[model samples]
Target: MTPRNLLAAGLFCGLAVACANPQAELAAHEHYETTGGSMKLALIPPAEQDDDGRYLNLDPEGSHGSIATRLGFFGRRILTPFRAGAGAAEHTTEAQVSIEAADSVQWVGHSTLLVSMHGLHFLTDPIWSNTPSPTPPFGPSRFVPPGLALQDLPYIDFILVSHNHYDHLDVPTLKKLAKQFPDTPFVVPKDNAALLNKHGVNNTIELNWGEQTQIGNLTISCLPAQHWSKRGIGDTRQALWSSWSVTSPNKRFYFGGDSAYFSGYKLIGDALGPFDLVALPIGAYSPRDMMQGSHMNPEEAIKAALDLRATRVLPIHYGTFDLSDEPLDEPLARFETALQTMTNNLSALILKIGERHAF
Candidate 1:
């Protein structure tokens, strides 16, 4: 095989083997009831796994595009050169972040948000890396730096990580957080704690779908998301993926780690929603055949917000990193367009990187 063909073959092998993880010992599907009151509204079902113990989406068929199609997508990415700094520059704010601010959320760039609510602080899918690639310097570069510098972060009560994808589950950033805040709990999906522990994040709380855990006065629930996870070679679907619902005495918030459009949103809404604010992904969705299974476009994100019965929508996961074929500004434009068509009272809480909005 020629060098290009050889590269493609190697990648194909890697993707093929990225199916089952031998380290995973997933339990049989069952409902878990926690002392935490987050489950008071609904009983979430256990996430399903295949015979190989690999996690499966509620609608597994066609969730991940075919292997051949994936290969073609990668081939195009490899052959088509991206100009350095092709996208518009990101606007950032350097305002002082108050640690005691209550009921506020700040966008820290793609999937990362610093949230302060009900007397506690929370962070979601915290990635500060310049690139999402495991092997850096060769992948899509981050056009924007982290909205809030690490040094400016407040004392976090807990951190929620959605999955093992490099972008969402950034180990380097996690390690930094772990080192800085050794006592903070890092909540992650089943089969993902071991990886964090191996990397020195000792205080990890593993939750399967349907499980709820309590921290202070807050109740955190592991909710369903239509997504898959793969961080290392041969580990696809080895670890579960999830969105999160954090509930307090006066308000509730939903942080969608990453997901494609699915009916689960309505279920979640009917159960523990009409949320005060729902943060949903609205980027990295293009080449529908390649992304439709995992990433939701801006319009789908709008639909998801409505399905969740969100009082307000916080659009995230866009304009920070180059993860798809769409223009950097497209997601927001489409999101705004979709917003114009909304006849309901649901409002959008659009934040520039580093910008904050009160809930």
Candidate 2:
């Protein structure tokens, strides 16, 4: 089948599955009705059209190319039962290492980070599921297991969610985390409070951009990110997206939660300069013509690091899932090339999937 045909089939399948699931359909309608707010979603111009005059939606942009075709290729190559066994083994190894560490941060695959500081543990965008789709049966499945399993994580004092996208906000993962750390507080974007509430996540605090809250001795401030958010197709931009500046008495860290290159980085730098570390997304961007507006390529990711003036940069959001056209290693390779071209004093600390870094 052609790429276009595959894309259509995937969409049709997803839509049909959504419609058949009464709970999903009801959730979609109820979410839109309550969270649509006064923001005129209808007034916003229709998505820009491509040459074919079809509205170019950002969520599944370039759906026909890398997303549909390459994913299909991998989906067929990997055997489900074997993959499950391997995933379990990998998860066990990483969890043992993470739990054994005395004072270090573990990259729990993708944007998930577990920071251990001042006797407190924090998890960022913790998605332990094999796939980041709304339904377990479809969408971007993890090629490998999460570095740390949900139950294996230490007593998490707090969880930070940047936005409402499935990749960033997996409801099942959150439900599991909530169950494990029953009283642990959750920090998320202001408008997304309802979604968590619906899932029985009561210990959630919503913050708009520039707002700060304290968890133990750590002071976390939500900073601006050049990204958009939505859980369903029609509820785009209903919630805000943001990076976060987490400061403790001894250290300051920045987590750039998936953003396009934008002036917001400079603003963040001006306000919160000389961070001890910055965790930035460095993948899932391809066919720049379509992705440049919402996702940053490697070079742009470097620029964001420079703008933030971080002492050490840790790249995330790559190497775990195949979300774009670029080769799996392209983002890191491009990052190295960009580093050589830079005259500024910027450095990066790239971690292996199960690696731990002491800050």
* lDDT at position 322, candidate 1: 63
Q: Which residue runs of candidate 2 sit more than 4 Å off their true CA positions?
A: 1-103
TM-score of 2: 0.75
Residue 6 shift from truth in candidate 2, angstroms = 8.7
Between which residue pairs do clashes occur in model 1? none
- Whole-model Cα lDDT of every candidate shown, in order: 0.78, 0.66
**Model 1 per-residue lDDT tens digits across residues 1-359:** 36655464335322311111112222222335543442453546778888999998876545446778667666545432253545533666757446465689988898999988777888999989875655554445677778888987877878999988777888889999998877788989999999999998988888888777877767788999998887656787899999999998999999998888898899899888789999999887766777888889888998999899999999888888766667888889889989889636789999888887778
Runs of candidate 1 exceeding 4 Å displacement = 1-38, 41-43, 63-69, 79-81, 84-89, 94-99
In candidate 2, what are the lDDT values of residues 33-107, reduced to their tens digit? 212443112212222435643323324432223465435544432322233222111222533344434446788
Candidate 1 local lDDT, residue 11: 51
State each model's C-alpha RMSD to the native: 6.1, 9.9
